[model samples]
Target: MGPARVAGRRVGQFPDGSESASIYMNSGTCYDLMKNPTKAIEVYNEGISKYPTVSLLYFNKAITLFNSGNVEEAMTTTESAIRYNPYHASSHNILALSTANSNKVYSLLAGLYFLAAEPLGKRASGRLKVVEELIGSNVKKDGEKKVNISMPAGDKIANKPNDFSSVELMMSMSAALSYSDSYKDETNIEQMKRNLGSIFGVLSETTAAKGGKKAGDKKAGFGWEFYAPFFADLQKKDFLDTYCHIIYASSEDDANTQWIKDNSCLKKLTTLLK
Candidate 1:
């Protein structure tokens, strides 16, 4: 899909409308459009140097790397992006695509995140379709235990010396709350939901433990951090309604089968259940 594969995956724009940030992202995007992977990587690296905490910069850089055939490096950079922000749906989506053949469980977990975080995203439908195809595949290696999120997304990523993003440390505590053991016997979307619910449980526990303060001092309410992507730009009740619906949704429930499409990429992923 060329470098353009990475173009539509961007989610959040530069913060505060900083001209420098826009220049960084715009230059990267421009380079990508021009099919100059070298220049795109340079621009994104520059952005990372200037704004070390900006996860989107890392995400864009990883995409360029992937398009340039630097698959290993791209995986590393994508993991960096996720370290900076667990809510980055695009980062998770990229990871899912990059490592699908290696780890079916991890790939599906990433897909679950991408769908949950960017249910209404423009490019998510296509990506979701790809992930759904993982259903019924016997890709698990022998001795594979629970979801092995311990390693980076790949060998190359594991080799890199990564500094834990503050976000990573904060979210790690919550990630520990994931239901790693509950879905060992499930497959496809059922397994996906178990992971999804596990992540929610983690976020719920972490947010409560933190007394409701997010990384930027934003006050969260109850399980808001777990549902941060949805709550980021919503009324409390609307966010709550969305969260409750997803947590309770079922494939057989007609209202949910229809409603999920409007609210998430679940509609796009429904084909997996077939």
Candidate 2:
């Protein structure tokens, strides 16, 4: 949502600047909307050249490459985005969708990444279910350990020559104070507790689950809250605010905006947050 719209923007102190801050912010979006991925990539390269720390440029460029059928390039660029900011939801989505389940770690983390994206997150629950089914069915039917999932047409994560692993990404998330550094909020602790529960809850499904811990187990492995603190503030937003943030990518105070609240899945998630 718009809440993260300004994510990659930073003030240019004249001496260290490349393009104007606003230009970097809008250029890629304009190019993409105009259906010119080449231009978007060019713009993103310019932005990254000057502001290498801006994760959004990498994210934008990754998506542009993905759209242009440059799957391998997209995967690499997505990793760069995540390296710059482990919580870049867009980059996570691109990687999850692009990376095939041939890589077990990304397969698992892809679902987690979708879930972690929160309201403004990637709507990838269906993909998770698909991955789950593929994983589950193959292990039961045959002795095959590598599960190749069938992706929806035009929605594949990536194709050809991909060995990107999420090992380092996991370490970055598990480290303490990562999210707190950005999210300074009151409900951070409570939010972390719930999120860790959900993460372990899902991970417990696989035999590869660390320490063989259950979803809600306290010792599911490492100190999850220590590494994943962004979940805290992500869960504290009101339903409508969450809705607006995700749908519009903006935090324009939508508490009073009336809308249907009949999504069954939304109900379950709300209960978890409460």
User: To one decimal, what is the Cα RMSD in angstroms of model 1 from the true structure?
Assistant: 11.3
For candidate 2, lDDT tens digit of each residue in 43-143? 68877888888888888788888889888788778777776776555666677666553443354454444443554323543544443442322222123
| Candidate 1 lDDT tens digits, 180-261 | 4644455334444433444333333333223345412323321132233332332222343443344334334566656666
- What's the CA error at residue 153 for candidate 2, in Å? 23
- Candidate 1's C-alpha runs over 4 A off are 1-19, 120-128, 139-253, 257-274
Clashes of 2: 12
Error of 1 at 185 (Å): 17
- Give all candidates' CA lDDT scores: 0.53, 0.47
Error of 2 at 256 (Å): 27
Best by TM-score: 1
Displacement of residue 237 (Cα, Å) in model 1 is: 21
Clashing pairs in 1: none
Distance from true position, residue 173, model 1, in Å?
A: 29
